[model samples]
Target: MKYFTIFASRNDTNDMEAVIREVYTGKHSIEKTGHDYTVTRKSLFNRWRIMLRVLSEDTNLDYFESNIPGMMGFYDHIPFADEHRKKLVLTQISALNTMIAIEAEKELGDEPFRLCKELLSKIGGIGFLQDGTLLDYDGQVIVYPDGSSGPADFHPRACTRKIRGEEIESEEGERRRQASIHELRERGIPYLDTLPQLPPVSECRWKSQEEIARRAVALLIVIQYACDAANGGELDESKAFVMGLLSKYGVEDQLTEDERRLLSEEQPDPQEAVNIAWQYEAYWPLIWALQLTDSLDFPDRICDSSYAIEAVSKWGSFEELYRQTALRSREDILDAADKTYRLHWACVNSRIQGQDAPAGMIESIVMERRRGLFWMVGCGMEDWDHIPMDT
Candidate 1:
């Protein structure tokens, strides 16, 4: 399934409603996994809404790791305005999307309408389980006796009636919640409300979801191919499809002339070449996250790629050179790269402040770079225009 579909079907209330009908009657107007206009547009708008909601809630989503599902933390940032106001904004935006979806239904088909309503239902259905009582759809909890674990404890004829009908009594819910709290406390797990407050984003690096998805697609294809080749398996047919895409983007021809030539002399397989390329691509975020956490587990190849000489010969600037070099995994090379980066950044900062970069500072930085061993630094370029950018 497409990434957006998974998110949409699971989170969008309208989308859920559409599916529930299909589930009940075993009838559908459209097929799943087909790249139809309705599916594609719904997926697009779902992603759009998610991004906007993130921005509206946290305002700093561009900086640091946005607390998006499957991206980072489950909480990105607190809502910017009052919670009610945020909800109002989200509702208004969603309603507008519903209107657009209605128009799409008229032109495209009922499938769009079904998808929109179901997706909307999915979003609306989300709720917090308050206190310690897990409520049913009717908001009533079937309580158990002290020793029983089955619903037999709530047999209409056998159990003592505390409060009948829907909605767990507030007192009962509190009592159950306290019991759960006590148990968790004994195990040393923090309560949800008492957990550490998320700090503001300190660095902005991640771009739009589309950009991330494009990178992800490239990296996933390369890695999947690598795993297949690493196990002495034949090349996957999907490699050809990805290759075609690369060709359309003008990247395939470049790779064939340059990267392919280099790989032929080293890693003989085309799949391996792609894998290596993706390895280079995947390293960027790992390094960035590590830096923010002040934890290092990888080598810094951001300045040690063998392509550096050829790339520089081709008039590649420092940033391009660095991004290319960031692809390899040699320990000595990564150390040197990190040192170079540290020195370069330091020099830039010194110049910015009208201070002379200290004499032999670069040498000291180079020496200190040797201290990192067995580190698996990630690969990628820092935005040069943004000084003091995240790793």
Candidate 2:
């Protein structure tokens, strides 16, 4: 049942009233019973249109000008630009609602009355007159001022200047610049050669062969967990399960005919199996992990190694590890894991080949898969300081 009225100066009051009347003819019931017009509508959208139509049609009158029965009215007569003046009016309204007299204070007996007086004093241009007219600090009535009263003249607060005469370089512009430079350098441009040359890839830090071996062992422990989870915790069953996964992912192609025959024998050397897995260009660590788990009886090896523990935590869980391996998949979880393993393997080989391999090459590789696996199991790219470069 609560109602509010939109008011403007007498000059454009008729126009404002006419706009509201035409827009809400059949949609809402509008009554012009007294000096003020009342509008009733069940739909908030129609009510909003009433306000928007009134303001859009009449540019002379301000939109914030309103009259509430019990509250002091506000008016800004200064002829400043629309943008700058709106900020001041909004700031005043915000201060009134939040800081001056909060609605909650009304529940505290006479606190609301006391706060209203305090608010009137703090806001310099607002006061309640004896004749029910709200006047600003300059003695200008906010609503329907007398004919002799004129709009106040004040300096416009906003001004504009060109900060830079030229357009700034965007991200695309920087990218284009780099591409151009690279194209020039590829053609062996003489000017580019005069620029300082970067230090050789051999000078950069790289993973030692021993570190790579240790990482291979750590990955095996992780694969063991997956194998155990899939095969009901039986060591022999888990080994067969892991071998099935490997064979599905083309791990068999990486091994020689002799190595494949040896895998059928009982009690194969874990180190020898890992070395054979390392010969492949892709999926080597993953293949090594699978083979070593089948050959070695290293229980709790994944939970104990810092690297394995970190890798599991990054991949979320061993059971649902391959879920984030790619943006798209072929329905089978093992297939997805295989694809992810191959991609990671390619990235590691690229790093070992050279430092300046390609622009964003390492980043592209990490971004294509789960970032955590690279840090913990792959090349430790997340902890870039530990990432080994080729000499």
Candidate 3:
């Protein structure tokens, strides 16, 4: 059997699926099945809205049993189905921001791979075959760097999450770190059980010291540019620098919702501009990881922006930064990752109970910092753009 494969780095699956339909159905108006519901992609002018019907997954998989091939790693990891019939499956949707790598197979020809190549071209995505070939969006082989790779390698991006609800007061008034997990046991997150465990350092891959150094600088540039756009800096779409940054570093897919909107709108949202400015919190830890700074400041307040900027900008070039770079161990990064993960739960619990964040633990600070740490630890191999802050 021949196989077809496609990989996409998209902020969310909504746009990717719509574009996929455009390629699949020749731009004709049609309804189809998607991850969560049936979707109709056509916009019929002058038509009234109507109710929708969705599909049911009533079909059995390989005699009524199938493992979600998504996170479980390899097919060779667990043998399934008949020792006779050939089996091929691909699953998972970027209902959230995600890096999606998919493969399809046909008993005869390579049409599926051809179609997948088309999809890849349209989405500006990349691909990796089981045999270790990395393909560009146009389905041509790319020069693979020697020996260093991971989720960060394929999807080299920095990310941020949107904070909803009324703003919670953040301060350094309380001088204690967050209480232990047992103390907050009563404040269980409903979705807590559903989140993925942090994969061990030995089991996961990592970005190189130089690449991490370059990307840390890239994150600062992206945050600065995006904050500028959101605060009425420049709204025109013709500027090629923004496009270059967004595409090259996968930055567009990693934007906050309001930051994403600022790219299209003629006017900018002032509040979100301030919000994005505070996103310096996300960049600081990378500086720490690169050994630019010593230790992270306590997360009870905002990151020192002046220091973060000076620390990163002081480097004359990527090589200059790489020369001074030293990424900490994955174990070290994961330790902080786990700590922040729990602190995020505390912040959520405080908001849920209508109380201030415990011990003055700043919600946004904890979140942005975790975004950095989680990205460093590969966030359970999650795409950087939409790494969940789920506790």
Candidate 4:
């Protein structure tokens, strides 16, 4: 459950170093030798450290979160400023746990996946119900196991019509109910299990899908600006840029011509980029929680994006930004990304689980960001030599 900041070298060399800075914990000594920097800490569960290890070995993964603990439990007991804040945190935890469960099912083998689901269910986090419906701890269904609610009723009339070579089909409503029932039986849920599963998590169907997509796209846009600024106000040929980003989300090949055209034509100013990044404050924490950069495609995006270039180019350097603005603007962007990510999960979880999304969740997230309470850059690069070699 420990938290740390990763400061990577901003140069283009095979010997780039990453400084792992531990925070909110006991002091640790920092040791530097050649290209490797280490902060000796007692904790064994260093997420970034493990991620780097995995990346260096180039292991194949079915899903990014499969091996990573959901980490939502860390926030469950932490006190927030208000009820709204507390709700926001809880909702985010639920959404994250749900996502983890989905990944487990998709990636793990039968025994391991079953155990994972059972463990989550026992912990009251999120997992599939006995009826194969996805749900959070509160018994709100998020995804239907059979992809439908129930089966259709048997109709004597339909049988007669078919026997006479006439087409007779069950009503859509009846078919849906029957399909749901059949799925419930297959998943071993009680035949009478009537727990309502509301808005489905089917792709492109959820009401908040558009909002999440918009925010995600905005994030890439801001990142593009940051990359450009770092590369002397020009796109970097070596860096992945927009196409690289689109690929991470598995949407690169699916982009319509119009979307591609817009991305190519749009030339947003630095201020506009910052403003767009700020607009999605609620999602930032979720992004941080999910450790989006840990995904296989993400490191390349970060490395290629050259966010540090912009940090240095616009603010003179990371050190200057850190000293003068307390890294306020950069921190703000990270915070927004995390919160917006959480808000999205909350909305998705609510829709699937048949629960109302927390009221004013987005507004509360934005307000918290404005208050400047949680300010920390989740990840970034810096000049290796500039980092202090002492705790």
Candidate 5:
């Protein structure tokens, strides 16, 4: 009896059948097409979008999974399937704001080692990846001269969630903090059950600019309390509160001892800070948008056109105006952002296409006037069907 290796057969149509059987039933359902929905990249994309939408409905994971690929981690963590789950996690979650790293020593063996090494190399700072043992979220790592780490070193007050209605609020208020922490522990099992392990800040870039701004906004919490005490009944009105928030986020340069003392000293006025909060709220979306497009150097460098749309629309408070200005055809890339953005793009495109612009004018005019141009510019894109050069 001669037993042959069927896998060595010239016609390998069987591989597709195996993929259909294994991958189809695994995550994505077998659709009317009678195949795994994620077989094609396009199909996988569709499935990913569906999963993202479903995940979005769950408010708790909003802080947990934003910019992080929540479901994709499940596939990578399957022990038999892949061991380089850390690297995969880093790649998927690196670009997004809001990263979390879990410690995996006894249970997560080898995974933590790879995660720590990558984090240390990519992002080096004071508490980013505490001794490559613990994970820090921001670019800053908290390293003491004595070599100790944890909340003690950097002391990040995480956003514990409180259920008020369908939405969740941060655990700033004392009463809310206690209630939220309890609810989080009870309801958070699903959110955390399948994580491979949390890598450090160096492991991945967590905390989008929006999240950072929000944390900085926490400094306002202190400011509000201080102002209430100072005013007695009136408002202790000043730029100190706003300045303190920016200083806390490290957006501003060096501060005087007076400013630092003030921030450390007292609480802010709630009513005054309440009015100020709207500006910070508006700033958050723009900050997030800036971080999103932070990678782009020249307008020509922007390869991902979808992000270009978002950068224009939500970068500022007036979402509708941007939406109208940026209303381009589905396939159109150039006309999707703002017209001022379009002008900057034209300059870049002009450079890339070897067209002549005023000397050094493109460089000066392109990115600088984006904020100003964004406000006044209108998008009256005439030709939507034409795909811009190289796009």
Candidate 6:
């Protein structure tokens, strides 16, 4: 029951039904309303020419998030260019990637091709709603509604024309593209001429640094109280502080599953205690996000619990801690989000391909960092659990 739309040109004069019958190999029905033709293909992405001709329009893709399989030769389509935009020279269609997969990228050497979007939940962290799968025949990603890190393919109902479909799908063009990368690498850089403008911040009000500081403080309070309960420390004093935070910010709901259990019960299972320790991994990212710390280091190991505890402990009150906070600029936060997004893709890909994580990245570190970044960039989303972290 996967439903999506194909955006075809109004100028396309071919009989819509005939076109579908010619290009689509599967048994499906097309309900031609006005300009739109709704077709059900028993399968998706089976042929080269069929794939190209299916898309005579792509402007409708704006309703969905777009990902590039590789660098699109924007210069190849000068008519689609805008001199005022950074995209004019060449804009890299970024898919989820890490350290720029220089070798894997050779498979998708720069060539003029169309882009498409999935009409799925646009809210998931990079791959939360989308699985990274490649087309069996072509090795291009199958863009679904939820999301797709489409490095090199399109659906019959997806794709757009940056140039004639024939040239791009031609044997000569494919051969040229294979050789193009090595020559470009040998002579000059094959990197983005310009970065596309990232999606703007959502209209939802962004949480102030003060609010996040309070959140961090509240979470720590609960964790500390849980520790005392576990270690047979004075519950009375610790409960007072934890209750105070709950009374104000109520970040208790933000705790991990085990941490939430700790709120009710005094004792933590041995397994729970290990998870609670990893809460520092979660806590460290928040402090880093708030600029309370500089960089969040590599994820191969645990973050310093002492430094994490001290971060909130040094400030006498929640208000005092927030007052000292200077959140990073939107650009800085987005950069981190972009970095995590790509690295996360790498981490997921490694597991799928049975290889080591790129750049020694651990799943936990990337997950924690992604959780923090997703929250920060998500504009108005306040609930920690509500934040999506699939990438």
* lDDT value for model 3: 0.51
Estimate candidate 2's alpha-carbon lDDT, on a 0 to 1 scale. 0.32
Runs of candidate 1 with Cα error greater than 4 angstroms are 1-28, 31-79, 83-115, 122-271, 277-301, 305-391
Q: What is the lDDT of residue 194 in candidate 1?
A: 16
Q: Give the least accurate 10-residue stretch of model 3, judged by summed lDDT.
A: 85-94
Error of 2 at 376 (Å): 9.9
TM-score for each candidate, following the candidate numbering: 0.22, 0.18, 0.46, 0.20, 0.18, 0.46
Local accuracy of candidate 4 as per-residue lDDT tens digits, 77-176 = 3443344433433333222211221222122444433334343343344433334343444334433444332222211111111121122122432343
Tens-digit lDDT string for candidate 2 (1-391): 0111122212223444554455445655665543334444456743321112223112311222121101211233323244343333322322221111112211223432233333333333243333334334344444332212224331211111211101322443334334434543464321111111111222223333334333333334334533344333554665576566444433344333434443454554455444333222112333223332122111112222344334333543333443322211111212222233333333443444444323233423322222212322332233412222211
Candidate 2: regions farther than 4 A off = 1-205, 230-391
3 against 5, candidate with superior TM-score: 3
Clash count per candidate: 31, 4, 0, 31, 25, 3
lDDT value for model 1: 0.30
* CA lDDT, candidate 6, residue 35: 44
Q: Model 6 Cα displacement at 133 (Å)?
A: 12
Off by over 4 Å in 5: 1-69, 96-233, 236-391
Please give the lDDT score at residue 232 for candidate 4: 44
Q: Which run of 10 residues does model 5 get worst, by summed lDDT? A: 1-10
Q: lDDT tens string, model 6, 232-333?
A: 677677767777766664455555554567665655564555445445666676788788889877677778778888877776665677777888876566
Worst 10 residues of 1 by lDDT: 48-57
Better of 5 and 6 by TM-score: 6
Residue runs of model 3 more than 4 Å from their true location after superposition: 1-197, 233-275
